[model samples]
Every structure is written in C-alpha cells, then in structure tokens.
Target: MTIHQFYQPPLHWQQFEEFAVQLLAEVYDVPTAQQYGRSGQAQHGVDVYGRSRKHGLIAMQCKRLSDRDANNQPYPGGPITREFFFAEAQAIEDFPHAVSIWILVTTARRDTRVQGYAEELNEQWEKNGIDRTATVWSWDDCVSHLNSYPDLRKRYYRDVIQVNSVDDLDQMVLETISMAFNRTAFELPLHIETPDEFLQALQDTQRAVRTGELLDRKSRHVIRKSIGGWRQIHNRDWQAALGKIDKDLRALRAGVEHGLKDGSIRRTSNYLDFADRRKADELEELRSGCVRDLSAVLIEAGLPPI
Candidate 1:
C-alpha cells in the first residue's frame, strides 16, 4: 500500500469541473455525460450537460469556488446569490437543448441562502412552466457523493486508492467522515437552514463508514457493499474509531429526524417551521461533540484533523 500523511489534496478548478461531470453522470446514471464547449467561447451558460435516466437533459454550470477565505459564511453580495443564479438561468434559455434541471455546482461550503434561492427558483419556474428547474450542489454535497460512491473517491484521491486492507478501509472511512462533518453546517443545532436537505444528505453519509455497506437512497435497502458479511473488519483500533463516529451520527440523525418528524425542529420552505428549538440545540451540541471526537481520532492516526 502507498503511504501518505494527508487525506485529500487541493484540486485545480479545471479538475473540479471535470470531476463534477463524472460525479453527476454516476448519480444521474448517464454514461455519455461530458464537458460542454471549450474555454473562451460563447457556448451559452452550461459547463456540462447530458441526458440522464432520471432527470433527462440535465445541465450543470460549475463554479470552482475557493474556501481559501472562509469555508463557511456568505452574505447578500457574497460569491453566490439569487441574482447570480438568475443570470445563469437566463443564459440557459439561449441554449438549443431543453434543460430539465440546471444545477449550479460549486466547491465551496453549502449556503442556506443559495439553497433557499434555488428552491424558490424551482417553485417559480415550475409554476411558470419553464423548461428547467434549479438547484445548488455545494462542496459538502459533493463530499456526500464521494462517500456514497467509493470508486469515485478512490479515483480522485490517489493516496486512498492504495489502501489494501479492511483496517486501511476503516481509516479511510474515518478520514472521509472527519472532513465531511467538520464544517460550519453543524454550527447552530436545531436552527438548521435546510433540515430536509440535511436529512437527505445524511442518508448518503450512512452508506458506508461503520457499516461497511451501502443503502439505496430511494429505498434505504441495506445492500452488501462487499463480501465477508459482518466479518469484514478485523482491526480493533480502526473499528473503535469508526464505531464512535457512527454512534454519534446515529444519535444526531435520530435527534434531527425526531425534531422534523414531530414538528419540533421548525421550518417553512426557507425558514422556521419546526416546533422545538431547544431540542435542535441539543442535536447541534451533539454534532459539535462528534466533530471533536473525529478530530481526536484523526490526529492520533497522524492525519489532518477535520
């Protein structure tokens, strides 16, 4: 196995755009997806477009953002906005092909404002009988996809693909979860911006890690991810670390879903609707504790703390 001290390395903007195309193809089940047009050319707004099994003619505009400043936090005049998406939405109108879903893909953290705006655009466009809908796939969303599809992660992260044992696999899982959760998304507890979306994404995170299995997103069927049944992992240290992370995740998931299901965690399209903010705070605190545990394990393993 190859040795590396780090988990993920920085990717170039062009590389990211290419990676997004491949990822969308996998998620959408499109084998022929490819980049749209060359650089410095007026080829409409889409950076990538392909016909998918589910969404059909999906168009993606990649914005390879930098977390060089703040990984989280955005404002009215920040890097993205409703107006920014509006301009791209208009540009898609000029394209010859009818688009089903026009996704604004970025490498930065998830922004509630952008997500809420996209949700709004989806409603307005759907009502107006527009040709396409809109959505934002932030970096966190991309990471979830990475975790859901291990092949994609291995292909991108050279150091990870070299992992040769179940122990190594657990370490990789820990690394993935560490980076996935160590974000500002879990900052405020029950006051989550898009609770529903968080629930959906968490389903993907649960695909592997401690379980060593994958679940069908729509059905949640527990499919065997590999051979050996329950006897796959043998390393105690790796297992303990992954087990702690999974325990916290299960607790966190239960709390969030309970709040949403029982109407305790408030929400309304873009804002408040859940019934309980206090319970949400408890979940948020659990998330913070999970982050600390992940960092501790990662540091002990000589990897970068999430």
Candidate 2:
C-alpha cells in the first residue's frame, strides 16, 4: 500500500494480528463459523489459532520483527529456539482433539535455517501425536497471497510493497517511529522553554535510535554529528539530551553496521530503506524544531522573527 495507506489508524499491531488470523482462516477455507472461534493471544508464544475445514486445527506464533532484525545474522540457533518449539508443541498437545500447525510468521524474508528449524520441530512434535507443522512466511509471501484476495488486496497492497518486497516491514516500523515522534513532539513546548527546543528535537533523535530504525554506522554517525553541531549552534548545555542521543545512536549504529558488514543489509534492502527514511524524517523534524524554537525566541526578544 502507499505509505499513507499502510499507516492508517487501524493498522497497528493489534489490527495486524487480527488481520493475520482472519487471513489465515480464509486462505485455508476454514468456515466463517469456525473463524471467530479462533483465538489469538500476543506474547504467550502464540498469536493466532483456528481449525481448518479438512486439515484440522492450526496455531500460529507471529514474530513481527523490525526490519533491523531482518538485516542481521541469523541467530545461531535459528529463529525458533528449543523453548519456543516446546511451548508451541505443548499448546497443540493441550488441545488434543484438533491437529495443529505451528507457523512462525515473520516480517523478514525467508531464511533456510529458520525454515529448517520449523521442519525439524514438526518431526519432533509428531512423535507425541501433536500433529504440528511449522512454516515461515515473510512479507513477500503475504503480498503474493493477498493478491489472490482481490478485495483486501486492492485495499492494502500498494506499489510500495511490490517495489520493496520484504522492505514492506518498514511501514510497520515507520508507524512505530511516528508514535515516538508524536509523543515527543507534543511534549516539547510543555517540558522546556522556547529556546530549549533543541533539547526536544534531541529527544526525538534519541527516540529514533532506540527504535532501531537507523540501520547504518555511517548514517548514524552523520546524524550524531549533525545533532551535536546543532546543539552547539544553540549553545545549550543539555548534557542529558546529549547523553541520550549518543547512547542510542551508538547502539543502533553498531547493530546496523554489523549487519551491513555481514551482507544482511544487502539481502534486505527494501526493509532497510524504509527504516533509513524514518531516520531521515526524524532528522528533518529536529531541524524544523530548531527553526521553530529560534523563531519563537526572536519573537519573544521583540526582534524580527526569521
């Protein structure tokens, strides 16, 4: 979808989870009567559940990893740790009458190791009559599958997804970053004086880094240098602001730089680009805030405001 459409108020994680449950139910031809009966509980090692018309029941564990994680080394043990496998298998076993499929739905593109772990878990669960199967679906799979459902597809699948593929995860990340932006943006005037607007902008910069959307060492360094230069321009001590920005920028930069050096970033350019844009947008917001603050100060001093 267009970035604008992807970020409609109804597209938060809660809404996405519901959409995922509903989509899976429809795709498998599970009866509508049985669809609402499906249960979803976030962070309990499960996100969606339902019974298929013929294949029996299905259980899904959704991991909505940020684009940052997509562009990183596969955790050595794969995405499914033994604990996660055991918990999903246990959930299936607990519901004995229905056959279950444990699916790991990620925003990341397909990874062989992650796929392999799912296959291995299925085999292990079979020994206990749990009848579980695991599969990994990425943003690419979602777009391809959704295309068949012309109605919903037409509403949500924009050129952005097609162009970026896995990078579509950025829509979600951007939404998240926007949340922080809004929070800090509103709080700016209330928390500090007009001249201290740089501090507010600095907080937003730190917020972006903490959100993990800035995915490059050099990119982050540029941001930090820019913020530092701005802070000096304003001649405010703002040590607290400086520390927060420095810490977050360093952490985010390290992660992205590591991913870049390992080739993960290249493999997931679509997702990374979106994240990069969010960081850029944040920098722009900071710059704008600086200008606003300077104008406010000029007006307060009875000088012609720029």
Candidate 3:
C-alpha cells in the first residue's frame, strides 16, 4: 500500500479539524460532527466526536505529526510518542458509553511503533469487554477516501480549487449581459424594413428592457425616469401597447393553428419566403427603434452635457 504523507508544511490543528469534519460528512452520512481542542476539560486526547450512520456514534482522537526526520521517516522522539498513545487510549475509555466506535485519525501512517500501540489498545479494550474497534487511518487514507466521493470532489473543485473572488463573479455577470445584448444587435438587418420589421424592432426593445441593460446605463437616468412616467400614464398607454402586440401574436398563432387544424399548412416556397421576409423586416425595425430610444434616453439624461 502506498502510504501518502501529509503535506510537508505543518498543518494547524484548525485546518486538520476542518478536514476531519468534511471527511466524516462525506464518508458515513453523518448528521453532525464537532471538534474539541486542548482548552476543554475532556481534552486528554480526543479531537472530534459525532454521530455516523455507518458506525453509530463515534469518537475520534487525531494526532497531527510534523514532517519526517533526516531519514524521511515519521517516528522520532517528538510530540506523537508512546505517552500520547496511552493518553488517547484512556480518552477513548472515558467515552465508552457515549460512542460506539473509537478511531485514531492521524497524519502518521501505521509504522511498527504505531501499529504496536494500536494492537495494545485493541487488546486492552477486548479485556474490558468494550466490544469496540480501534481503527487507524493515515492522512493519505482519509484524503483518498474523500476523493472517492463525487459530491465532495465537486465541492472541492467549485469552492476550494476554483479561486474566483467576489469581483470576478460581478465582472462575469456584467460580461454575460453585455454579450447577450451584442448578439441581439448583430442579428438585425435594419435597411429593408416593413411593419414586420417595426414589430421585430419593438420586440428587440422589449428584450433589452427585460435584460436590464437598457435601464442599467448610468447616462440614461432621465430617459428611464420618463419611461417610468409613461408607464404610469393611466397604466393604460403601456397596457394598450402590450395588448395590441398580444393581439397581433394571437392572430398569427391563430392563423398557424387554423392551418394545422384544417390540414392546409403546406411546405410552399412562396409562403415560406413571405414569412421569412416579414420576420426579417419586423426584427430590423425593432432593432432600429430600440437604438433610437436608447440614444434619446441618454441625451435626455444630460449625458452629452450640451
């Protein structure tokens, strides 16, 4: 088994605690897990405790080890000593009734010394009729298990790995809106316009208004205000205009529906050409009118300063 070492740099207790919580959340469908530090009264060695679906309620004692010595090995006479193991064993004993399983989650892999300690603890627990297992997982195992969870991987990719700030989010939203408006502008052919062109122009204006870009321009405050005023004109002027468009759309839809219902809708080239020309003319007029309105609004708002 390839034993993955923890990151070479020292990880703070808080960082380890967060990693543990996230891992447990992914692994066993735990509803909640809590972290406790040395400041608490129960801090002989226990670092975390929580309820888990896979193993009932569990207690975890975490031992964070630093980088290995000159031989690049974990065991040296440092913080994670035999004494530390004994203390953790005692802590697990203290929480016997509350938690079903006791675990030692550590940054160190199971070397000879650590394996010996784990075996000793298991033997002691069996002697006491505790019926609990003392499982040990190195930092590498924990990370590997977490990586296996697709949801956790996605969360890490979207939240932690993707380093986008708030400003970047705002800029992206602005750019997307600008691009959509530009696409609408690009699709219009305004020169050979008709009543259909005028309708299309109005539709484009409606789209711009709906997108908020037409209102978002800082220079068009007065025009926006005037439109707002016109909007309130007995609520009837704007309502009547909208009603007329609705009526026209309903008429077109009725024609299509009638044709379909009567089995008269045919693939005729003349009809297709007329429909295409009408749609093009309407869209062109709509685009032209939208641009004119937008320009007038900007001018009325004292944007040009003359």
Candidate 4:
C-alpha cells in the first residue's frame, strides 16, 4: 500500500540524476544543487554538486548500480561495497575546493559494512587533514524521505497512489476470499487511496482486540474473529448469513473430497463435474448460495458487492 515499492531504478541515468537532484534539494531539504556531471562525460564520481550550510561543500554521487538482466529489467543490487564508496571519494580530488560531505546515493539497500568503511575512511581523511566526511544513501533512505513528503511520491510514482473507489473494497474482499478458499492466485490491484489512513485504523482495531499487543495470527483467523466481534457490536442478520456461507463452502469442499475418494467426480482443469446433470446442478447451487450470501454480507458491511 505504501508507494515505496514502485520506485523503479530509472533506465535512463540522466533522468535518475535529475530526479535525485530535485529529491535532495526539495524533499530532503538540501539547498542549491548544481549538476557537475554530463551524460557520456567523465565525472570521476560526483554527479550533483551542492553546498550544505551546516556540512560545507557536498558532492553527491548517484549510482543506479543494478546490472540489466536479459530482459533489461532491474533486479536487486546486493550489499554495498567499500570499492564503490572509495571511487566516489576519489572525485573529491577533482573539485576546486575541498569536499567536506561525500554522499553516495544508490538504488541498492544500505549495508552496515559500507557505513563502517565510510566512517573509517573519514577518520583517516581527518588524520591526513583532508576534512572529508562520507555517507551512503540507499533505496530505503529514499523511501523514508519520500514518505515524509508524500507529494514527492505522487510526483514520481503516481500509479500506486491512485484514489480508491467503492469498487476497490469489493475487489479486495473477493481476492481475500479467493485466497482463503485456496483458489488460483488473482493479481489484485495494489494501488489504493489513503492506504496509510486505512492501515492506521486497522492497527487501532487490532490493538483494541489484542490488548495493545501484536500477534502473528493467521489472516483467515483474524478476519473471522473480526467479523465475529463486529457481529456482537451490531445485531445484523448478515452476520449469521456469513456463517451459513462458510458452512456451505465447507460442505461443498467435503462433497468434493468424498467424490475424489470414491472416484465419482471427474476433475479437469476447471470444476469437478458429476456424470449426472442434476448432481452437477446441485453442486453449483451450493457454490451460488455461498456467493449470494457473501455479496449480502459485503453490502451490509457497507462494501460494494462483486
């Protein structure tokens, strides 16, 4: 639900550099960024040059770091390396003034080893009177900054930040039920409006029910328990209808199991069918009954029906 997952490593390095410059200047509150590197030109390592009022001259090195796969899709870049950081540090020699703050920004996740190396390197630089400091920014750091300023996320990854509609809940419920029933996985739309708001409310309800303690309970168990709790708060007939729906689904599954044991039902890619049309119809009636009850409960719960 968080727009963080959709931050694609841009195939075009220029686009990434531009975005990073804006991101650092606006979102992260870094001031006065100047692009020192050009496409197809040697930059040593520095991509964007900026001055930090507190930290002095800052040299930002942007690295996409992901090797293109056969399909040219960006896969995970593994642990950060000291060699990568050292290369960026070498760029400080080219600058007219001493670079005080060296930042290596990558699409890869941050590694503690890289941080430790940077710290050690900084100490050595201090000993040698270089006055250089170093830091590494990874994908997660970008997410945290973007999350703080949601407008930036909207600007970059708008697809995952679309406004949710009534239909979304219906689809959500349907997909949940499908998963609960052990059906083939359906790719539900991940985009939702105000997902953080919904997640907060969900957490509040969970805390109330769980005595402010978190537990790793099965999702199906949690859902059923929540429905039962809601039923106690509101005396709704649809609550009983939901129970009946569950019973019908279970009975249908039982019937299938028995059929499989006795070799009475033939199973193919689709539904298991009996030799008799009447038997097949009876089986279908149970399925339809469960669906009807589910739709009624969804509507009663103020969710749109599928």
Instruction: List, residue by residue over 132-183, the lDDT tens digit for candidate 3.
Output: 7776666556657755776655554343324245333333322322332343
Error in Å for residue 257 of model 1: 58
lDDT for each candidate structure: 0.67, 0.46, 0.49, 0.56
Candidate 1 per-residue lDDT over residues 1-306, each given as its tens digit: 533222331245678778978888888888888999899987677998899877779989988754343212222224886788788878988989899988888866777888888888888888998867788887767777777776778788656557767666656555555544544455444454576667655555554554344555457654333322112335566557566767777888887777666777667775535565567567777767766766787787678876
Question: Which regions of candidate 4 are displaced past 4 Å?
Answer: 1-6, 67-80, 163-306
Model 2, residue 47: distance off in Å is: 3.0
Off by over 4 Å in 1: 1-10, 70-78, 161-306
Worst 10 residues of 4 by lDDT: 184-193
For each of the candidates, the C-alpha root-mean-square deviation to the true structure, in angstroms, is 17.3, 15.6, 22.3, 13.6
Q: TM per model?
A: 0.49, 0.47, 0.43, 0.48
Report the number of the highest-lDDT candidate.
1
- Candidate 2, after superposition: displacement of residue 178 in Å? 12
TM-score of 2: 0.47
Best by TM-score: 1
